[model samples]
Target: MADEYRPEFIRRKFTITESLDEVLKQMADRYYQGNVSLCLRASIESYREILEGEGYMATRRIERQLENLVDEQRTLLMEITSVRSGLQESHRESADGQQLTEPSMTNEMVRIIELLKTTGDGLEFGDLVEQLDLGMHKVQPALGRLVDRGVVTRTGEDGERFTLAGFSQHYLRSGP
Candidate 1:
């Protein structure tokens, strides 16, 4: 009964790279307050959890896949929350009593908006091509998309100029 509270430890040692040793030391310092032994034990429990159920490589692979799926679930939840908040913000009104909107834009559209900002009235199609360094095949489709979305305008004798319009702010936002 006297020895019941006393714990016995099985010790093992393996060589690791200097960088790994440094990382372990840093983790111990921050999380365990320099309790390296406790840190090691906590880490080894990850392997123990996998092996205890059914000690096989297939079991380990399945557990790792489940862990990855959990991580992806967390990521998707964060994205959904972000989209909900953006929707709420879009419905808000400004101090001037004008409704503010959040426009969905791609990376290329954001770049187009930024380039147009550098010009005074607007940028001609040729200017966008020169500044953006993209082929006509790419730029034309994106311009057409923006014009359809009403976030951009085409006003000229033959519709040669493409200007960022309607949207209050650049925002420069994109996501899944």
Candidate 2:
């Protein structure tokens, strides 16, 4: 009868919290007695109770921690997105080589015709890089060429805006 007796009955009646404590006690006893199977069973049942219990504050704490973690993750993602956008804008602006502030009018005129012909809609300096794939450094000199040729005209301060000049037709066919 001693050989047939099992300790499984000890796990059936206790509350989750009480059951977990009992299971730990049983594991300690089993380890001393060399009853590995009994120790393993108690450990498994204790885990089941903890997971199924409605009043488990540990679970709630874990969920709150996860939510806070998600919020931090979202904030980091937004920061990365903003930084990437700034870099892309900077790259687009510099793609055309250089600024056009000192370009000769002749070079400016030729560049203007090319810019309009390529874009159809006029281009800003930034747009020039995006549309023409030229660097900003090359843009000014080319714009000067067009300006001197009388093929392009600037209408605003900083040459923020431009128009195909009196000779749009000539440049349109001849290629700047």
Q: Clash number for every model?
A: 0, 29
Residue 91 lDDT in model 1?
49
lDDT of 1 by residue, 15-52 (tens): 98999889899999999999988988888886786667
Model 2 deviation from native, Cα RMSD in Å: 15.6
Please give, for residues 1-176, the per-residue lDDT of candidate 2 as tens digits.
46986555554654457777676567767673756456667667768878788437777888999999999999999999999997566433222322323333344344545457544335676776666666778877776666664545675667776565543434444554
> TM-score of every model?
0.37, 0.31
Query: What TM-score does model 2 achieve against the real structure?
Result: 0.31
Instruction: Say which candidate scores most in lDDT.
Output: 1
In model 2, the Cα lDDT at residue 82 comes to: 99
RMSD of 1: 18.5
- RMSD of every candidate to native, in Å, equals 18.5, 15.6
Instruction: Name the best candidate (by TM-score).
Output: 1
